[model samples]
Target: MTDTPKPWRIKSARTIYNNKWVMLREYETVAPTGADASYGLVHIHNLALGVLPIDDDGHTILIGQQRFPFGRYSWELPEGGGPQELPPLEGAQRELSEEAGLKAAHWLPLIADVHLSNSITDERAFAFIAWGLSADHSFAKDSSEELTVRRVPFAEALKMAVSGEITDGFSLVMLLKADHLLRTGALPPELAKRMLAGS
Candidate 1:
């Protein structure tokens, strides 16, 4: 049997800053081949919770907002991460309330460690599924955020993802994963009907 490859062992790790949203670390590592390397690391604060907020009738709530970096509004979920790591369910509930003013009756941990393949930073996003929401709540957005929350069926969200309208990597991963869960009976039964309703 072959041994699995292990990452170079870290000789030391130093915290550069413990910020509100991310913790920066500097690490020194000694490689198997006797090479030494240093890397600056970012530990994201929140678990990167995304809520596929669903209603009894199986509709999802989506948000379209201007991402200053992207220079346009893109469809996405209510998500954020920082030092305040609420339980996944509470995080999902809070994001739903803050972004869409909705509260899900049920929440499930879907998956974790979804990477943004194109980023220079090595990061992961954790996703969840929220079900049995009553209705949209009035959003309380950040001063910099200009968003318009939109409600759509899950089926349409899937199409948007397929067509590239949903460009955020984390959001795409979560919704698609939620779909997979549905197929395998991992998704909440009450939440399953909203999957990308064909327009």
Candidate 2:
């Protein structure tokens, strides 16, 4: 909705920091309330792509890794960043194959360009539900990545999301939404049945 009204007006902007992944800028602006204001914006260089893979047996894959920023081990969907100029689906597919060694015959768009932490950052995310999967032995990962992949029943994965065991924002949202769509007759009957088998 480009016609949507924006009350804040930017007077000036300058980059405060720049890195391979992000750029931080300080903006001189006029607030919605008609007051002088300054805001800091974090501009992400790539689009976040997330994939939740469901196998024929109602099993879903998760990847375990140590998060550099959090300095802790985390379990999450196969996710990574895609260059802004590339299609998000390609990135999602690559992440799934490389991190989980699987490829899907069918992919469903779950979420698209959802902003994360919009208050300060312009990081946008896309998610997909992938099924009809099979192993891809030639899958390759980034040299810097060290991921542990696990396959768990979809029902158990959703339980983990509810129990706070899966805390990654992208994974949490995708898992919960997939469960909702499956149970509510939103997805194809056969696919839903396969993914909800033990739920």
Candidate 3:
């Protein structure tokens, strides 16, 4: 047999639950082995956006808050959801400002598209590296969020990701990728130079 694989044949699908934020659907399908099976999928109504904001001194921002679902405090890169109608980059920028009170003059996408929790959810994420940052206090935090913002050295953030001190999957991916980019000289010369200079 050739390496090409056939797609699963979907017999039927029905939405079991739907709200403004997410939809749950169940699908009856025929597997590649011709076996009948059922699958459940969670469809997120918005795009997941995350930003790693770095300043000229190689400092990155982290936002802390108590995660309700997980029942624990989490420190992560500034992250939020973007409506499907909005561009992912715009959403990232908005989250950077709202969550951390910072804005960037330069933005580079770190992770273009990631299928977070691919097995159970159709949730996708876009992450970015933002530099040339400055304070922007006009935007207010969301009512549901009580955030504590911190600016830490880039190396420290990377360590947090590696040590599991920061458990958010999106944040871990972004920080690890940024560290790789910086170490490999993959970033633009000027930006790399700034990011290498620790505060």
Q: Using lDDT as the measure, which candidate wins?
A: 3
**What is the alpha-carbon lDDT of model 1 when measured against the actual structure?**
0.72
Q: What is the lDDT of residue 38 in candidate 3?
A: 100
Report model 1's TM-score to 2 decimal places. 0.80
lDDT, candidate 1, at 198: 24
TM-score of each: 0.80, 0.94, 0.95
Q: What is the C-alpha lDDT of each candidate?
A: 0.72, 0.89, 0.90
Displacement of the residue 65 alpha carbon in candidate 2, Å: 0.4
Candidate 2 deviant stretches above 4 angstroms: 1-6, 137-139
Clashing pairs in 2: none
Off by more than 4 A, model 1: 12-18, 82-85, 113-124, 136-139, 194-199
lDDT (10s digit) by residue, model 2, range 1-199: 7675658999999999999999999999999878999999999999999998888888888899998998989999889998999999988888888889988999999999899789999999999999899888566788888889888999998999999998898899899888889878898777898897746
lDDT of 3 by residue, 1-199 (tens): 8778968899999999999999999999998888999999999999999998888888888999999989999999999999988889999888988999989999998998799899899888999989999998667889999999998988888888889899999999998888889889899887888778852
* Per-residue lDDT of candidate 1, residues 1-199 (tens digit): 5986766789999998897666888889887666898877777655676777766556677888878766877899777652344556666666788888777767777766666642235555666777767665555657766778888877788888989999987888887887787788775454565553322
Location of the lowest summed lDDT over 10 successive residues in candidate 1: 190-199
